[model samples]
Target: MREAGKTLDAALGEQAGLQPTATILKVIQLTQQHRGLSALVLGGVEGVKDKREAKQKEVDEAYEKFDALVKDFNNKAIDDAWATPKREWQDLRNRISSGAITVPESYTAHTALIPKLLVVNDLTSDLFGLSLDPDVDTYQLIQSMYYQLPYLTEETGKMRAKGAGLLAKHEATLEDRQVLAAIIGRVNDRLTQTHTALNKAFVANPALRDKLEAQWQSAYDLTNKVMQLANTHIVRPETLEFPGTEYVAQTTAAIDAQFAVNQAASRQLEIMLNDKVSDLRKTRWIMIGAMAGLIALAGLLARLIARSVSMPLQQAVHISERIAQGDLTAQIDTGGSSETAQLMRALKAMNDSLVSIVSSVRGSINAIGEASNDISTGNADLSSRTEAQASNLEETAASMEQITATVRNSAEHAREADQLVGSATSVAARGGQVVAQVVDTMGAINDSSRRIVDIISVIDGIAFQTNILALNAAVEAARAGEQGRGFAVVASEVRSLAQRSASAAKEIKELITDSVQKVEAGNALASEAGKAMHDVVASVERITGIMAGIMMAAQEQSTGIEQVNQAISQIDEMTQQNAALVEQAAAASESLQQQAATLQDAVAVFTLHERDAGYSYQSPAQLTPRKLSLVSINGIA
Candidate 1:
């Protein structure tokens, strides 16, 4: 750290000394004042890392910077020193900065002993380690003359004082006659020119013309006294670095060489960069093609696997969906796979089973319908037979009632005649007692006979009148329109009934006539009997006491005959009813047989399988109907 501090202090001192400032001595004199400054500057020129770092950090830094990043370590150190110019770099920098002058950076080969442009600077230099031309100090005396002169101020004082300083510094002797005279001559000529310029300037200005001559005369007298003193000290100019034409020639040549080298390097770098860009483009294209080919191969294999497995499975699923929707005709195109074949076989079997079941159900329903129809037919036939039998029985019973009434009436009449015969014989006993009583009884006999004839004639006439009315109604019915044809037929049957009644009436009239005759005869006999009955009454009173037994016996016999007639009539009526029932039943049985044949034809339309579908249609017992355990005609069983 301490060595670094000392180095920093020494570098600062060299930088300050090299910077342009107003001073009497040359740059070499300032460097000689600090021996350490020379060594420190040399070390910085070697690119000491810490010193470079320290310089960058200095505030308000006045140094010009180069592109240190582009240069090597040694080049950077040397270039940085020249970046902001000392006296060595100043003219070149000024040419670049200003438009006052130009120096050629590069030169063409020319026919000259000297170079193209001469750059004269203070540096003691060489041209490629070769020295040339005259002794450098001889021309050095000429270049120093202008620089050594002091600025002329205070009229003549500046030239005299500046000459005395130059003589003292070069140690000019009092006996150096030619050097002294030249110095004296320059001073005298400059003083004369100064006074002339002042006179012309003042005389043209009318305000200062009077003061101008006095001032010049006083300044000239003082300047002569200064020259006598300078004569005492005048010698020669100092020995210093003043390399003239040779120095400029060397620098110009060096600049030309550097320019050529840089241009060649720039051309080479661009060639390398273009080659790298072309190589990158080719390599990138090759890699892209390889990657694309690999991807295409992978995709092809994936598609092959999917088609073999997933596509077939998808077709199978579609087939199943159609079947579930009740489209049994749907078929899968599995391209001849065993699983597809099995599925098709199963579906076909299910369809066949469903068809068989439906056919069997239809067959069973037909059989049940036939059995119900047959039962209904049988029931209708039985009801019809029962109705016919009931009607016939009613007709036969009516005929039997009429015959029994007639037989009963006859038996009563026979009992009444036998009683009269017994009374007439008893009347003889009363004939001797009175002739008048015999005549009264004969008159009563005539009256009773006449009443009997009258009742029988009225009954016969009523029967005749009823028959005529029935015949008249039949004729009226027959005259009605065609719609009354059924009534006409019924009326015709009534007319037949009436005709039979008329015949019965005729027979009844004849019977009545006979009965009237018998009654008249019975009355006559009774009158005669009444005469004898007077006498007979005496015997009859004895016989009526004894012959009441005969009358009782006759009444019992009549009652027996009436009961026999009733029994015969009932037997005849029962026979007629049984015959009617038999005929009706036979007709109904034939109709039922015809209906059975029709039902059999109707049931034959559909087909049924023989295989038992787990149910029976009907029992064999159902073919024969009986009244036993029959069901009602709803769907109960």
Candidate 2:
């Protein structure tokens, strides 16, 4: 169907391509007439200058139409071909209008431009696909329009130019006659070619022949007449007699007749191309409709097939969804022996298994809850007893601490008593040494008193001798008389002094003897006190040794008590830790009981068969209760 659409597009494009060929043909015809008129006017013919200007205008207008048509084609090669002719036309018109051109120059210029326009016509036909028409009738018609008819018209135009130029000059040269003869021969040749093309077109399509026969015959006759007139009046004669303006008119009439046939052929070609494009478009739509009908029929069949397979699968999906949502009690009817029925039976067995599994899980969860409760209760009782033991141990530790402190204080006091006894012993030993020195001083004082008594006895004996010497001196003085009276008084005074000296010495001796006796008594008492001090020093030393022993024993007792206290504290701390552990175990067991209850609640969401209710089953591992000690529980927990 898509390929048909492309063919239809191509046919329409070809039809569009044919549109510019008509304008191209029109430009060719107008330029040919303008070429003939240019020759006549430049030949100095009267009354033809205005005709030439007018024909030039007509040619320019046809060029405008050709420009518009070529623009639609958008083909650079065709446009370029048309531009050369258009430029030459303008230059010829300017030369003729400026009167700067001679007869041959003007005629040559116009002739040059007409062939360029013919080339443009051929190019336009090829651009429009007319030269390559697929059908025989259209192809023949294209040959006539693009080649045969243009060639015939060009030859006729040449005849017109030459004939008109000779007529306008009223003279004919041999060279001019030869050129006219040559143009005549070419004209005959083009006429034959044109007839052959038309005959071929007619044979190919009798309908085109019926439509174009009269125009073709008219063009044929007019072409022949123009040839005859040229041969007799312009080529054969040495001088010209026909009016140049009338000659241009007759030749133009022949060219117009040829163009008329060309137009008819173009119209027939357009009609045929249009019919071809229309048929292609109709066929494309027919194919499109047939394709659409086939697509609709396929879709209907596919829908019926999908319905047959999807319906059963949808039922199976629905049942599977129920199972996923934990509806284990859903019933299944496996009626058919198809694969889908087998799938339903599998799902039924899965549901029954789930019912049994869920029932067993529910029973296990209940048993776990009961065991956790019992464990929690036992932990609570153990916690109370452990706490009580920790409390009693705490009190015993406090008492031991007090005893340890008392023993430490007693040891400290004993140490202080021992230091005091050592100080007293040192003081007593010093007192004994002082007492011994005092006894030795008493003995020395007694010896000094005895020496003093011996000195007093010697003084008494000297006083007796002095008394006797005084008596002798008195007797001598009596003999001397008055002069000796003074000597007698001196002797008497000496005797008295001697007597007093003896008495004083006896008193000193007695006092010295009494002091020596007291010194002896004091020495004896100091000797006895020194011995007592020595004995006191010895007793204090013994007491210091005893106190030291007592202090050492007290210190050892305090150390032992402190070590016992530390042991009791450690035991108390362990008991506290045990109590805390018991509390933690009680809490953990309670949490386990709650978790088991939660598990039971979670399992309750699954709907089970009534026959599975109260169906308790325990595995061999769960038949007897497992007892775990505290150490094992601590490790596991």
Point to the candidate with the largest lDDT: 2
- Residue range 435-503, candidate 1, lDDT tens digits: 545456656756765675576566556656756766676677667777667777776676677667656
Reference-based TM-score of each model: 0.16, 0.47
- Model 1, 198: alpha-carbon shift in Å? 64
Please estimate how well model 2 matches the true structure, expressed as its whole-model Cα lDDT: 0.80
Query: What is residue 162's positional error in candidate 2, in angstroms?
Result: 1.4
Model 1: how far residue 46 lies from native, Å: 37
Counting clashing residue pairs in each candidate, in order, gives 22, 0
lDDT of each: 0.41, 0.80
Candidate 1 TM-score to native:
0.16
